[model samples]
Target: MAEWLYEAGIGENRAALVSRGTIWKARIELEGTGARVGAILNARLADRSTGKVTLDGGGEALCDPLPPGVTQGGPLRVRIVREAIPEPGRPKLPKAVPSDALPMPGLTLLERITASDVPVRVCRAHEPDLLEQAGWSEVLDEAVTGEIAFPGGALRLSPTPAMTLFDVDGGGPLEPLAVAAAHAVARAIERHGITGSIGVDFPTLANRAARAAVAEAIDAALPQPFERTTVNGFGFLQIVRRRTRPSLPELLRADPIGAETRAELRRIERLPPPPPATHMTTQRIARRLAQQPGWTTELARRSGGTTQFVSAKE
Candidate 1:
């Protein structure tokens, strides 16, 4: 049976798509990142330039040429079709249309249950480790330092401003390991919600036949529609995937100042509740944690333990 393991935490919301007890995909939504994908916003055309329309209240979104008879700059109802992602440039809201004329709502991370055809269940919050068992926690950590492992080898995932890159590592037979890396890469991409341009650096393999085998493995692993380059002699393959929302790493690693602080708090939640008392972290982390209003109390409430933070000196 498939289940949607959900945890509504104080700082963020998370969900895991699991099939037969193994998590296939994971999602995280942090506070302050507006939920816009399914949001119906009242907007007016503020400006238009170079194939982009700036909405009055909603920010600029790239759009196709406005259909004839549809003029710009009037009270228009617009729905956010595609969300803005940090990589490969800003969001090009390619599917905004007249709210009166619509087909159906878009499926989003926030609204997966209703949109999904699979049987779904909301996991209990007390069992935070339910999703953690199936590589969920490791991927969260990988969001900070992009390390992922397969049986024979491992790959590191890092996103540059232009594209996300996957570098293959570890020891094994070149062709077989490259094939394994390709499979692992596809799984990691799905699990991490990675999209946009991606470049995979497989270990150098001069033989075209061997490279063909690796490509086949990748195609089998990731059935999602994507445009990809053939593995060259230098062992580099580039793929460009459709971007929907901010990836897991992009959402988590967005601001260094808050990332570690939020991560530590999450770690603390998973621990067996300490005696009802004060807890301490480094002064830097403590200060960041303090910035999140009401989180300490919320954590206490959810964990069934009371934790108070007192100002500390270095």
Candidate 2:
């Protein structure tokens, strides 16, 4: 039976759907990403014409279909429809719309996973790390590297402002390679929690029949709830998914130092009894750990040993 295993790690929360001792799907929620989806809050109309509003807390949001007769600078309630998205230069703000609903905080990662149809298993520190045992680290590496190797070839995922592009390459017959790559592409998208616009570049097949076969492979592999164009003569297919939050690649690549810090914490927690007294690593990692006192406290509590950070420089 497949179960959703959730871990409340320091600075981030993780969840994985595991079956047959393998991870089928994984997700990570980083701390302080932004206002979560489904949160209703009060906002002051900043620009009535543009439907721009300032959240009561300290963020900007675009609220469309403004309530009737809402004046500029007037307080109005809004519900968050989408979380902020990270881009190259500046991040896109959370999107909301005017609402009369009561104000409430968004659901936490744990709450969301438990609400899923799959059985939920909350992992404990003292117990074995089920997520790691199910190949969590390898998935993280794949996200950071953007390289997923299949049997015949590999898919290079590149996330750009416009869309996430998957370039498929392998040595073999064009038809077979395209078909195999189609399944691989679907799996990668699902594994990485990739959403929004996506483009897959497969080996061009001149034969109409070959293109149809590749399309059929994609339709069988990828799940629904998405819109995709037919494989064109150029062997390019476009897919669109509902975008709310940043994908896994965006999170890891955006803050590599933070990712490393969390990974180090995971490593330290896995040590045998009487864990190391102090962790010696880069100054950046030391600073990151120090900034999160709660994380250090939890690390100490779990390891049953005092935790300290020393710069490797000395």
Candidate 3:
């Protein structure tokens, strides 16, 4: 059975689909990247040439190209394709707002995940570590350093502007072990969200059948809707998976909610008796803490004061 571990950190909610002690899926929901997809909005073309549109909600959206014969500043309807990410001025709208796109409010990602009949547990107290729980520490290490080390050899994963490359280096002649390594690579890719093009450098095999079998082994291990290159004479194979957003490395680097929450928690732990009654943070963090009633109750129980979180701007 699959269970989901949810940690409602300050600015984001981190969730992992844990089954058999392995993380099958991981999701990080930030305040900025909420579910704005498919949101129908009344808009006007502020500048069709530059693909900027003014939404009814105020502020510009980088909309997709208008259908032919549409004029600038004309009243139009568009659907948001992606939510507001931190990098840009405005979220982007799709080229065509399909009439079928539902007019749905943004739903939190964790709500959608737990709605799948999976047993959901609030894991902020345990301070859950999904990667360690999976017992794939080495695999995760590879994700960090770009190398998955096995007993004999290792697969080096590197990211280029185009694709993530996996170079297999220095393994022995154990066919079964080689096959296992191939499967491990596939699992790593899926678990870490290593999307887009991938290249693998398998140990060069003189025998045609051996090379073919290794290729098949790796091909079977990976997920669907991907293209791959067969193992070449120089022992290289490439796989390409469709990509939209940034990969794991990119997310992990900029992920701040968890770290910030933990930092605040640590400060609370070491706080002296005269703690402040008012806790200040961004509105986003305050909202998340409000959702965790039990956490606030516990906070009050530990510290000798009734504490309330408010947005810093307030």
Candidate 4:
């Protein structure tokens, strides 16, 4: 059996000893630093082989369970490591880079849902005004504009019930664009206070350097409020946000239109017929109409020309 003592910070240091065949108690006092700190003490046998190490007086076992062939009469050694926590009121600088240069990319749609007992109103169109009234317009606008100008991205309504997913698209010129796309997605996630799962799909980058850079950019953009874990080997970034309140999607109670509505919109916009009533055909039409001295004669002259004209009032 061997005995040794170890100490860490100021104040009283605690210790316990265990022998292969028997238990022995040891006392050691740590030097005081007079400041709050943390330390760890470790005790080990001198001999490579010894009996099973057991603590005396019902204390927890200390030494490694498997003895590494300890020899008898070998010198026992004890080591201590100490660490100190900073005092309160310490000023800390921002460790993260500014988000100004790297704009958050993405579009956002807002919907509101009331509690079960609360009265609710259903409107015809997605109301941007209502979202503005709720104080979310600025946040959404900033996120979308940041994403568009900074990177190859666009913000869209997240289809999930209680979560908003900022889908980052790496449009064309794959490698460098993918890296920018990832950074933009990360920035949007942070600025919007989006909670729940955020899934970002980066375009495939053939170059190893480009991939690594994109990964680094992602790490830099995620905020501390959420736990971010990267699957580098698998090429994915997973984020878990600590959420307190319902996200924008949940608050807005907006449901993404189904495939039917999307197809209909495409059909209407690409209609084979002439332009719609609201379509702008000529840049000078408004000015010419405003300055017209004789409206009937001016209209008659324009009608004979090859250019088709539509009256603004009509």
RMSD values for the candidates in order, in angstroms, are 3.5, 1.6, 7.2, 31.0
- Please write out the lDDT profile of model 4 over residues 195-301, one tens digit for every residue: 56665555555567767787777777665666655434434556677543333233223211221122222222333334343433333443443444343233233
How far residue 85's Cα lies from its native spot in candidate 4, in Å, is 37
Cα lDDT listed for each candidate: 0.72, 0.88, 0.63, 0.36
Candidate 4 Cα errors over 4 Å, as ranges? 1-150, 155-164, 231-235, 254-314
lDDT of 1 by residue, 1-314 (tens): 77777766667778888887777788887775542565555555545443355555446655444434545675555566667665334533434544654333445455765467765556554455777677676767877789887899888989777888999998968988999999999998988888889999999998999999888888999867898889998999988888768788877766655766766667677777563477677777788777875787777777888776555673
lDDT string for model 3 (1-314, tens) is 77877766544466676788877666666545533555677777788777777777665567765756568888777776654433223323333342334455545767776678888877634354553466433433444577666566676777665667777665457555556667767876876677667877777766778778877887798879788877778777788886544455445434344434543653453467666788787776676567666556666666656777789788
Structural similarity to truth (TM-score) of each candidate: 0.83, 0.95, 0.65, 0.33
Which lDDT tens digits does candidate 2 get at residues 1-314? 99999987878889998998888788889877567889999999999888989998879999988999889999999999888877778877789988888999888778887888999998876789899899999889988998899889999999888999999999978899999999999988888889999999998889999988888887898888899988999999998989877888988888888999998887788778888877788999998887888888988888888878899786
Report the CA-based lDDT of candidate 4 relative to the real structure: 0.36
In terms of lDDT, the poorest run of 10 residues in model 4 is: 91-100
The order of the candidates by lDDT, greatest first, is 2, 1, 3, 4
